[model samples]
Target: MLEKIFKWILTIVGFALGYAATEIAKNWGFINSIIGTSNIYRIGFISIAIILFGIIFYIVSPFIIKLIFKLTGFLESGIQKIPTNDIILSVLGLIIGLLIANLLITPFARFLAGNTILSIVGSTLTLVVNIVFATLGVNITLKKKDDLYNVFTFLRRFSKDKKSKADSKLGISQPKILDTSVIIDGRILDILKTGFLEGPIMIPSFVLEELRHIADSSDNLKRARGRRGLDILNLMQKELMLPIEVVERDFENIQEVDSKLLKLCQIYNGKIITNDFNLNKVAEVQGVPVLNINELANAVKPIVIPGEEMNIHIIKDGKEAGQGVAYLDDGTMIVVEGGRRHVGEVVDVVVTSVLQTAAGRMIFAKLKSAS
Candidate 1:
């Protein structure tokens, strides 16, 4: 029913345009002479023109509708790819630019008075200027939004008579910025809930974008991990008491997420909370503080000394013959020499030595009797 109404509206618009064309044609000297200034003939000519245009529009309306639908879908998809804050800033900039353009054109419009061709030219120029300025404004605003935000925030701080409640809510110190890997690991949420982490937790816009891309990835494992990370983030926001802030500031020139995160930490004078080894190393080299979850886990694991005895269920064979492997409750690997034949059975092993490496801690042991 809606489609039928749309087609009728198109037909009516076509008829109106056809009538306007006939009026313009009647103003021509040759056409006026041909029509002979008769009201009956003029009405007949206009009716014929309307009917012809109405039929043509009716036939093409479906194609036009399909094209419009396709264009709408394309625009919707394209808009979805841009962050919400960016779109808002771009629109604001465009509006401001058009307003400025109008102010500039209004004074000059009077100069073209009584000259139809010049007036038309002036109007066209105004429209072109508005479009050009608006486009330039959008590009400039998007590129400089972070700088503008900082300037406005700084000025507002000085202008205020007293600190607002909102300002007081934020900690005096910088926030801990979370990267994609830490969020995906899902331990950060638990850590935040425990009240061990201080200040508001900051999630950069680019990190969220990276998670979104991962969630939409083709690989099943990656998609699941990404979706789990998103779920963990939502849980942290809704269920945890900690303040979580999604920062809009982003380094557009930086292509790597880790690189952007390090830059963000530098900009905000904040620490990065992540489990990615490479990122942790980079942050250290850059003199940025990083709270590595892996390091924390390793720190909290139970300490073992030589000659310590513990019972473990041998789960698999190690690289060497007769060597069985097991894991501690905290996931520390234990290599039991000469226990491969006892795989799938519980055995008491005496710790011989403990090795700590960048990856994790490992313990070597042998049967209690062998020790």
Candidate 2:
């Protein structure tokens, strides 16, 4: 039914155009003089030409409209994806551009009133003005997109502060990646409760795999540690309800877990949280910043400087002869010179020096002389 209606419309349009062409030719007189040989031939020729042009236009019209609509939809989607703030600014800029074009070109158009040269120059200027406005609109739109993102970020932060979890606001800051050892040790929960650690806690997929491996290990201790790590991870995800993201990005090229963790840190602009001393050293050598739980524990321990006397009970012999080994409250190893005899005995020692490395800090001391 619709197709029939369309065909009727096209036929009417063709006849109307044919009639108009006949009138135009008669008024112009050139076609009339040539075809005055026969009225029927003149009418037939004009009618056929108009009918052919109308049929051609009608056949191609739907496809042309379809292409136009497709292009418009695509452009609309692309424009929508641009930040809202940018869109608003660009639209405003476009309006300003049209106003400026009108103001500057109107006088030229008036001055060129009757001369063909002036008319050509005026038309060219008008085309340039339109092109300039279009180019400025697109440029402004793209440039303001970043500003739109920043505005949304700020609004989100502001809205977050208005709700509950006011004390937990620190979780919204920079992210900190958690490793298997630190999760298993489980001191981070206590640390987080005190509100010292801020930002999102990221657990990489490889770390989860490591925990799973440990959980499945034949060795009882390793299995227990692995299970414990999994439990801590669940607690963080469910109970403590802290912000956590499991980054699934895996390194097919790197096999080592520590290496993958370092790479993850570099990718996320975050620091790795681990307790492995060797891993800590390796991270330092690779220029990846690490937030070693053990290091943090040591830094917070009581500071003992040179000349400070402390009584330590040495339990074993050190690597060197006549040296005894003791430990601080935070598990920092203290090497006492000339104190092998003091093994298993608590004796006052004077701290002589402190040594710090990527692994940890060490204190070197000598037995205090009896006064």
Candidate 3:
């Protein structure tokens, strides 16, 4: 029924177009002279043109309908995926652009009034300017939305009292943005639960999507890690006092998740919370603050001075001969020199030195008797 209605509408439009074309042709001096002022002939020509156009439109309507449906579906899906804030901003931008276009085109419209061709050109120019400006406005607004939001929030707080002044002095605590590796490591939940992390915690939509991809991966290890991340997120949301916000904003132009996280941190003036060493280094290089969980863990571990003694069970051999490897409760590696012979036994060792690397802290030790 809809298809039939659509075909009928197309037929009517085609007939009107044909009649308009005939009228335009009739206005030409040569065609007017050729018709010899015969009204009957003109009527017959218009009737034939209308019938031909109507038949053509009816035959082609199905393909046109299909194309329209495809375009509608594509647009609907795209719009649905866009965040509500972005859509609102884009619409606001479009309105501002149209207003600017109107201001610029009014004078041109008046100047070109006497000439039809020039008037058409002015109208086309107006349309082109409107489209270009609208597109630019939307793109710019979306890209700088976080900054704009911050500005507005500041303005809103400007009228507040002494507490706000103190807050200003203390500096606004920017949200902590979580990355994929941090999520998979799953210690973030505990950190947040401890109230050590201030400000809102944000997980970007892209990061969540990456987690989903990992969770769906065919590799068992990756799948487990991904699932663990998701479970941690769920638990954080359920049991933690701090709200975990899932941010829908994304940098569509950025392909790498780590790069996107850094860009987002710049936008939000936020620190990234992650266990990824490479991400931590890159973010630091780019002047973005990073809260590395591994670094934090290392910092809080028992500080062992050289000559301090502790007992450890040698579970495996180290890369160096006669060096037995043991792990602290916190997963810190302790290398015991001359203790390879004591594998599978617990023995006293004296800490000889401590080495700190980007990865973590390592303790070098010798058997207590040797020390």
Best by TM-score: 3
Candidate 3: 10-residue stretch with minimal lDDT: 155-164
Cα error, residue 167 of model 3, in Å, equals 4.4
Expressed as tens digits, the lDDT of each residue in 1-371 for candidate 1 is: 87788889989988998898898888899877877879988888899988988899899999887788799999999987786668888998999888888888877777875699989988888889899889988998999998875665456445432433444475355579999999999988888878888877899999999999999999999999999999999999899887889999876556899988977786676789999989989888766789999999989889999988999999999999899999988799999999899999999999999999987999999999786
Name the TM-score of candidate 1.
0.55
Candidate 3 residue lDDT tens string, 202-280: 9999999999999999999999999999999999889988767898888665689998898787667678999888998
Residue 26 of model 1, lDDT score: 86
Tens digit per residue, CA lDDT, model 2, 210-279: 8999999999999999999898887777756558899987866579988889767755657788888888
**Candidate models: Cα lDDT each:** 0.87, 0.78, 0.86
Q: How do these models rank on TM-score, best leading?
A: 3, 1, 2
Clashing pairs in 3: none
**CA RMSD (A), model 1:** 10.5
Model 2 Cα shift for residue 316 (angstroms): 2.6
lDDT rank order: 1, 3, 2
- Once fitted onto the true fold, the runs of candidate 2 whose alpha carbons sit more than 4 angstroms away are 1-172, 235-241, 247-270, 275-290
**TM-score for each candidate, following the candidate numbering:** 0.55, 0.46, 0.59
User: Which candidate number maximizes lDDT?
Assistant: 1
